[model samples]
Target: MGVVNVTQSQPVASMPEEDRKLSFREKVAATIGNMTGTMHNQIIATFLLFFYTDILEISPAYVAGLFLVARIIDAILVPVFGVFVDKVSTPWGKYVPYFAILGVPIAIFGWLTFTDFGLGANGNVIYVTATYLVYSILISIKYAPSNAVGPAITKRIDDRISMGQIGYIAIMLGALFASLAFQPLYKALGNGNDARGFSLIMGLVGLVGILVSIFQVTSLKERYINPNNSQKTPLKEMISAVFTNRSAVVLYIYVLALNLSNGIRTAIMIHYFKYFFNNEGLVVIYGAVSILPTFLGVMVSGPITRRFGIKINVLAASVVNVICMLSVMVIPDTKAGIIIFMALNAITAFFLGASTPAQGSMMPAAMDYTEWKTGKNVNGLMGSIQGFVQTLAMALAGSIAAWALHVVGYVPGVEQSSETIFGLKLLMGVLPAFVLLFTASILWFDISEEKQKQITKELAERRQQKS
Candidate 1:
């Protein structure tokens, strides 16, 4: 119970900042907070595309273009958010303030994004476009500061990796719970209307999400960030620092690919199960079967990375993903094939979850390198780059799902042709496998743990010298 009496006023300043690993309570608090903060995004990601194309009768191409536009705007604005986060200073601390300020709005906008206003087709599109753009922008703003807090909390690479592992459990758990409950919750609330169900359930979940995110302010602290460094790095300089750092570029691409893969798989998941398998309920079962293996993968990630190194674990996950995804095509379209598909999904889920920690830790490691190289602690700006990659990836993936659906001749509430069936599988299985190739760029990321150790030591010494 190494709990410090941390309040908004003196968050983390009481603790000696140098290489300060978090307490057990602090770690638990961070995990729970992260789980809550991410819930809205999970809801949107897991079901929104399906909601748009299937329930609302929006054209798949239009839906795809809409998703793409929102995320593209988000991608561009995220770095500006990073710069804004860096420029701002307050008594509560740079990162913590965002959680408190944006918490309620995130929930509100999230629920709004899921809403189906009975406006005619034109009104619905206009309303949706406006709400989604607002929600998309807020997510980028919230996550910019939210992600910056991790690096601010500590400079220890092991702690960063450990936190990432724990954080991923929260991420997957949020998704698992959302996937499991969305159908039942919506149906019960809306009396069999999917639009009504999705809207009501998201509202309830958003309320809970905001409360937990706000409570996070009291448990976590921003120890490493200099409260007094009010000098804002120009956007041009922020861009230069991030691009010039080889590891940052690699990690950005890594983030983009990983997020894009997840976006495509999830955005099109309901369509796959509902049409291709004619068993939409299998979505919940898929989430259930994925739990044990995915959690086990997360549990083993720390040990695996420590023993074999992060690069190898990430590469291995990528390779496993390709093999398992491609193997899905060979499964016969029968009841037995469902079990085989799920089993393959479980294997893929495990590796994807396993690689999360190794993947997430790279961002902060890259940030440290940037700070060392430029003598500028632009953690907020750098964290936005991570967010930017995700925005861009999701943008592309969302559009890909829609375009593929439209091209393949998908129609709601009808029997699909074999070609459409093949197209669905390709979007779900093959496209994600291809996106995982983005990891090849990571081969150039030579920032080993040993390398990080020296950078950590040198940065600390330099900070001490400056003080």
Candidate 2:
């Protein structure tokens, strides 16, 4: 799984003469690059299913199958890719080159997924399978390495948190833009031929995202403490390292739960809006309300983390999210009721967004722990597990939504029954709330903020001594 490279051979502790700290501008540029990459992902994850089903007229079953297959492939490939990333020594550095080479293709595939070329059901399925596979692979390439790069860029705990805040703000904005634009863009492009237009717009967005990522690659510098750029570890050793790293395992479970909760929320949104509110346009309203809170939360996360700590913030936010989710169960779906739910949901979004930066920043700490404990750095492998967990959660959420629709006797492309409609309403609101409660419970196991700082300081001290 890993490749050996011809680079300076030294122990992980071999210290360079000087530590290169990134300038604030370089950090900001890096954050923007990371944000663009994540934004590209959010657009596809949030809207791709809806686009395929509603606009492209693909079958729910087929779409589900495609997601399942692609995810399975991704799960296997991600760890291997992680090893590959760890092994390679490039002029651009270990992890940044993937952004340059694969970023554009990733965006191109995103556009292709939204395009409707008048392909019949069978033809469309084939086209989607091929294109989607390419999209998944390219995304894996860019995502796994980019994730690994975050830690490589800086060893400063506070700086990493700050970088994560900037990245989170970017991600929230990207999500907000996609949420705000998808429906209007689809409509403006002409409902009949809008699929093509949507595809084009997404393609352009993807291209712009890639270019932004490239700017990050050129502008940001890696702060390598260990000057020894040695041959990559073997695949067997990498896998062993990943499995043995308890912190990585805990973080993986945490990420999986987070994704599951979020995925359920996303899958149920369309159903909730259409049936409960009796206004399809409420989708935009929902997006606006939810994202606004997230925007505010991301803005304050860095300072909050600095003051209170990541674990406490995450736990507090999870509790708030649970309250908000339960509130949705009590609120009806009428205009006034919807407003109340949206307000509560907005609060939930704020907490979730705020917690996300902390969680993301913690990942590098986990990677460092793995390296310290196991005498190896497997950032790519760790990130691959993260990617697998996230996509797996999305696949499960999609499947759950589809199956729920079928159980409630939801008929696509036709007028729905009252019972079916009622079921849809429940799925959108109550189901996600239940999932949130479960996620909140599991999140209690996370490491405290003080503990994280302790871990970071200890790892750095160890590296300093070894060097």
Over 356-384, each residue of candidate 2 has an lDDT whose tens digit, in order, gives 78877777877766665566777877776
lDDT for predicted candidate 1 compared with the true structure: 0.78
Can you write out model 1's per-residue Cα lDDT over 1-467, one digit (the tens) per residue? 11113122222232256866788767666566567656667667668888887877678898878877777787778888888888788888888777767777878888888888888788878888888888778877776787777767777777877888889888877766766666677889999788888888888988886777666788888766666453655667766777888988888887788778878888888898998778898877987898898888988888888888989989898888888877767877789999898999899878877888888788778887877677666778888877777767877787788887999889978999889999888888888878878877889998999888776776666556557
Highest-lDDT candidate: 1
Least lDDT summed over 10 consecutive residues: which range in candidate 1?
Answer: 1-10
Cα lDDT, all candidates? 0.78, 0.71
- Mark the 10 consecutive residues where model 2 has the least summed lDDT: 1-10
Q: Whose TM-score is greatest here?
A: 1
